[model samples]
Target: MTTEERDQLRRALSVYVEGAPTAPEWQDWNFQRAVPDRQHRFVTGPVVALVAAASLVLVVLGGITLLLRGNIPEVVGEPVTTMTVAPSVTATTEMSLPTGPVNPAAYADVPSFQGTVRYFQHDPALGSPGWQATVSVRFAEPMRFMYTVVEERPGDDDFLFLGGAGTTFIGDGTQIWLDEADDLPPLQTQQPGFFRHLFYDSESPSPAWNEICGASPERIGVETIAGRHTSHIACSTTLEDYELWIDEESGVVLKMRGPLFVGDLHPQVDRDGGFEFTEFAIAGVSIPEVKIPQVEIAGFFPPFHMVQEIDFGGGSVDTVEYWYRDESTWRESIIASSAPSAVGSFQLVADGQVGQCILEEDLCSVVPLEGDRLLFGLQLPSPTSRVPLEFVGDHCDQLAEETILGRAAFHFACDGVRFEIRGTWVALTDPTVGRSDYWYDKGTGLAVKYTGEGWSWDTQLLELEPVFDDAIFVHQEVEEQASEPWPDTYVAADGIVPAWSGPLLDGTTLDLDDFRTLPGSEPGSGGSFVVVYDWFPTCGPICLDGITDFQKLYDKYGTTDWSVTGGPNIEFVSVVDDDVSVAQRTNERLGITVPTVACFADEIDPAKGHNGLCTPDSPWSFWSIGVPSWTVIDTDGFLVYGVTGRDYDFAELDSLLADISGLTES
Candidate 1:
């Protein structure tokens, strides 16, 4: 590459390593409206205020940056492009359930109780009177109970969340309706909220709940919870059963135990499962004026985009009010999404605009929709939050298949991104969450909505709007015979990079300086690792014992800048048998390719002897493993650190690297 081209590539790599740019001031307020009933608020006691203050403080806390550096084998090139291979479909079992006998009484008696619970409270810290939430439950033919909660503090806003006392319900119910939509904030598409944060119906709760409930009733028995005598029962259809406590003499229900919110996306509260009955008085059925808005009643954002304009009723007129959120802030711009593309492979168009408005004049009076009010649809991620495609490294692995509700799912980790795909349910180590099931269409390569407790949203693929030049999308196939790997022909742009050079059990030279620089290394920079092996050639008990412990460490942190290499050390072609010279090794290892490997040794000469370059030299610190123990020089070519003999503290090695990386950062 020319000097200018090389510099440009270097700069690009540096920018990527530094991460995406800090967002500019956000002005994209598509929708903002005041609640009609401002007086209707929930009771937030001092405890709530304290919790809110803590959350706010935690968000503002800053963190320290640590610079880490490492090197992989020469075979793997820099800026690794990871490919996620979906697992092959497994054969369907002829008989779905294993032949084990079903327990005689596997199902539990699940009570269908309907009632709204209310509460009143006061907080000293907020100096405000508490709020109230009134919930009405209907079980059989409108037979129900209504709960009303009142907070009587001195001074404060009295607005309660849905899950708060007064209106909270425990039965399985569909959430994500227009009533609660208006209160939410606009959600960023790519960074969707965690599944636990969303709502789920009570019937099908989280997978973890299934595992706990699936245990025999004996395993989930009666216990005194919160000083209340209670009995635990498992429901056959739902993840949560029933915890019922009654008035011993009257036989009337006293307290109820189950999931508070009835949504697939509700976050789990393991300990807070049962509700104690306070004062229950009989009153005429009353419909508390519950003003369910179209947006999130509480502040919540949806994953969507919006566009708006202020004036211009005619063609080519003036007065445009364009706004968009770049992840954090709303931004105002003269240009609109309808305008031509400026950069990247994709342009995020709001779901509201696509297939709706055509000309700028048509969109002139378009008012921006409130983010919280947007239901799931064809929403695009805000432009600023879209991450550019980049590769992870070689320590990727395919996890086992997870099956749920007769649909199977697969999970794997490659580079750094975790790939989870749902298919036909199969048995998994853990019970599957109802919402985690994402069906990907084979033909279209897009996600189909997975079944939730009671409702399902179609996560269908929108149009593949082209953002890149046609040429960029075109793929090329390389002829195997024509494609030779690195270190075989060319060298890194910065020239010779010295690495590990030692003797294999076969007396062959072992040099591994060729792999791509561990994720973030500048040109001309390098690192080291010790490749220890148990067997001379083949596998046996000795080999197993020698490698087992080291393998454990590698698994915890695979291919880190500092790691202990595994596998038989015979992969490297020895110089004696192959007649591969040191210069040849250098050429083969330091070439342009995907994940290449290099070496510190030059050649294998039986007569002239192994290349002397393997020893300590300038810019490289040499190290020893044992008598026959050998390692390459450090970046500076000096011999400074070494674990000689059979003694080595694995913890010390990790700490040393951590210290070095810390110093570099400092």
Candidate 2:
């Protein structure tokens, strides 16, 4: 039969089978009782046999339908009756049930409890030494109250200094705003608040279950925590391994110990040493009233006044004074100073203009704020109540409940970002480069403690007092003088490249003069052109492709006998900002035979390292934001062409080479 006819037949058979009376219904039929005993037996016996045969036919037909639909994989010489229907059903059953020693469902219903949670990390390499935050959370019905006092331990501080105070909600309920504190403008996007149900309802599996659970969760026996008996569950993922201790009777998570994932691109978290949470105690719910400061400004009351100390790296510190006049309109004054001297000061009136002044130079400038410069130092972005859980949902795995900083939290890994459930606070470390950690109050979402890689600031929570003084937003009056425009410090394209020397992979020191000179002429030759490639060993595929392209160019011009004798020889060299070992590995991987130089002996020190003709002050910095930069120095040692990032435009390079070679030939 045709496929359509077979489908129609299958549908008709299904309808007939569904409409047929069951054995019990058949027995209850009036006709069977009405008939004489001898005749009834004869009739019922054949009818029952026919019914059973028809049911068998329906089952066979259903199997055939599934096979035609490709739901069942076809096999040669295999009876259709032997094939199992819905193979996924078996696979799912395997995944959900424990093949190992632990029954995860046993401890799934953790009783709801409220308490304070403290989570902290210490790494001497991070410079700040150690940082931690403690927040009080009350786990109850309509809303969970979260309140925390922000504190910071600066490089000079022997003890934690009070930074600020704020509050947050952990459930689907209206915020209890203090009569004195006015609500700030809502963020552009609604942030996902902490779900208290995750703690109270243990039946709902944690987000990281599949990732951490693996084939099965192993029960590590019972342990006492916070004076309660708890069942320990051991779990692991490809990233890190951790343990979760759930209360034996209550099922509430008591503690969790694991390493946090760090970095966005090249993620590296300390595997051996990680963050730990303990001393979880049940505490009474008490949310202190938060007072918002009111600042008087131009017939309007600015309800927020924030004093932030920002370390702009490189030993420069900027003390920023912020006064929010509504949402869009605000005033920011940044007093930047380095060790031994005050570098400069800038006051940004985000509504219209920006005024800047250099202290020692007696230089001042006022520029119109527009486009990209409009938000210059006004650190106002739509505030988030908590980190957006959806953004990291796909990367999240192996979730376990634990008490952090005295509050119930679900510890999980998202991509490389680790979460120790509390407020929307994040401590990020890019071990590939540097580390930056910030603590924001769950309620206010204001940063309390901030420690950057090079420059760091720890803000102690001062009193949240009213700003009666309007003069705080007003610019200080200086001696009346015309403002001078700020001069650009970066080198422009076509600027002369400063001479520098570094040893190449071939064990020969090459300087800019070496490339500037013609093949058989003196150093002042005006026809030679140099190509310097600036790249990093860890720059991935694009860098390798660029290296291959450069190698081809070198083979075509540098190695060609006629090309060298015919015109000015083009010189090609690569300067990598990595160790010799890394450079060597990359060279071997890419099959690169070109002369490569390691800028630093052991590490990537941008200040002291020789990265081609490109330095921190080079205009190339504007284009080469990340790696794989290329610079072409003309015969006169002037930068003729400079481009950042990998370019697949071999035709452009070829055309430039042809034009330069033509000039030499002429």
Candidate 3:
């Protein structure tokens, strides 16, 4: 197929499966990113393994993620499109208000939309994520756009470089760029998926934006923004809902309001006043009064910190801190613990970087990141959500108004929730949540209580502040009267995946030591090459296909009797970060041939798939930040190669096998 055709098919499949990097880019990254052995380093003397552990930079994201490469095409890809990002609460359009209901879905994402939209933010705490932008777009086939922010605040112009005011970003469905000026060669260029969260795509769209379980939006009249008619539409995929203002003539979303990629949303307006579009028309939209979409959030959204006491049954109760500052940066610290600082005591996340420290050992490690994401399949909702019910999915029923901890709250009957604390995650009120009660404060939207099954727990909001201390955000701190841990600095080094062992879904133990024996030095003859396949339960179609293809890989390249005796060539193991039960269900559903494990027994499962113990800094050491990654270990027990992401192909394994057994020239 032609490159254009492949790209087209890639876009089509991206909606179904989380995306992969362009084939050539991924192929180039396959081994180039892995650790290259210096002759002395591998000459069999004790060498210091950098505590950083040669961790590869990879990002795990929902929907789709992209990593571009090489040079740019002078001519755009097929159906290339443009886009901008930002949202406000509510605002009056300059044009006369129109009559009747309009369906934003029908006009989901149309090509060729260029307009300037006014931005309004009423955030008292965060001040405002960003100011408005005057932008123009042609399409998102590879969504692209030219953008610059409208400065209303003192530093509102800072967002032209991305500050609290908001970001100035645009993408041509294929290539995405941020904080670059026109009339200059692009200083920054990223894969289309990199800036995806900023603009809603128009082509081969995912169901999350346009269709919410086939639910219909409430058409609440139409307003003319930028002299063009727009439909104000609202809908809830669940208890939490969102509102969108779409161009009536085109499906281009004028302003997206509701939740800010919030796993949480509320019935109440996020905070009012939004973008007011002033101009409309294409031919590379000039700043003609700049007609733009202003997204008006409902309430004050800000960075925050909260302390809660969680009872983990037994005499073991733990105190956890939840801190969030934008989605890119945050920290989870355990000031006091019932048990010992259970492995990786403190974790600091900023953008793609995750820094973990074990105070007891004076050891710390930083894992490089690839994109906008969090580790271990965890979701960090804006602390200010009026009702952060995104994780509740649709399995919830509203309950009567109630008071908890002397604060007004909204109750719900739903399945249990999986909350992350320390290195492990737990399902509070799981299974029986449908019959149980979960309560959250009306204003803060923080869960105060959960009563379900045979147990009950309540969160003591010892403190909920609208602000985050900048000092705590530092990766390495001296730990003097701080929320984070001590000796945060002093990075350590270690070679070889830590003596990793975990329980398979069937409850069998998998020890890396079991596969380290090498009978002979003949190429492809002996010395075990353990191939580890990483996956998460939430991974999309593309990742699922990789797992399915793993079966074929095993059949052709992997040993047939490794389980019974030993395999000289390859031993394959698939791992999930969640509970083994979940992996069992996945195996049963997909009929995977590769043995699957859930990282640990049940105590510390991953968010949805991240192996809590296999964090890039851990012994099992695969980056917890990526899904569907491939890591190869040589008989010497060193992680020699890591392939971040690419569509599944058995041949890739063939190449890895060649590398591990020293048969590259063959």
Strongest candidate by TM-score: 2
lDDT of 1 at 142: 21
- Please identify which of the two predictions, 2 or 3, would achieve the higher TM-score against the true structure: 2
For TM-score, candidate 1 versus 3, the one ahead is 3
Better of 1 and 2 by lDDT: 2
Would you list the rank order by lDDT, best first? 3, 2, 1
Off by over 4 Å in 2: 1-490, 517-527, 561-566, 602-626, 663-666
Off by over 4 Å in 3: 1-201, 204-249, 252-498, 515-529, 535-542, 555-570, 577-589, 599-612, 622-666
What is the Å distance of residue 458 in model 1 from its true position? 35
CA lDDT, every prediction?
Answer: 0.25, 0.40, 0.44
Q: What is the lDDT of residue 338 in candidate 1?
A: 17
- Each candidate structure's TM-score, on Cα atoms with residue i matched to residue i, is 0.25, 0.34, 0.31
Candidate 2, run of 10 with poorest lDDT: 40-49
Tens digit per residue, CA lDDT, model 1, 1-666: 111222222221110001112222312211111112211212111111111111111111001011111111011121222222223224323213222211221112223232333222221122332332223332211212122222111112322333332212211121111111112211111111112111111122232233333434322333332232333333322112333333222222334433333211122221113233333222233322221223212111222232222121212111122123322223223332212111011212333321112121111122233353232211112322111111111223435654422344333233323211011011122223332333332322223233333323232123232233333212222122211112111122233434545454334445554432444666325444233321110112232233343444444333343323321111212111112231233223322111211222233354543244322242122222112121222333332233322334556644543443332322
In candidate 2, what are the lDDT values of residues 520-544, reduced to their tens digit? Answer: 6664465568877777643445666
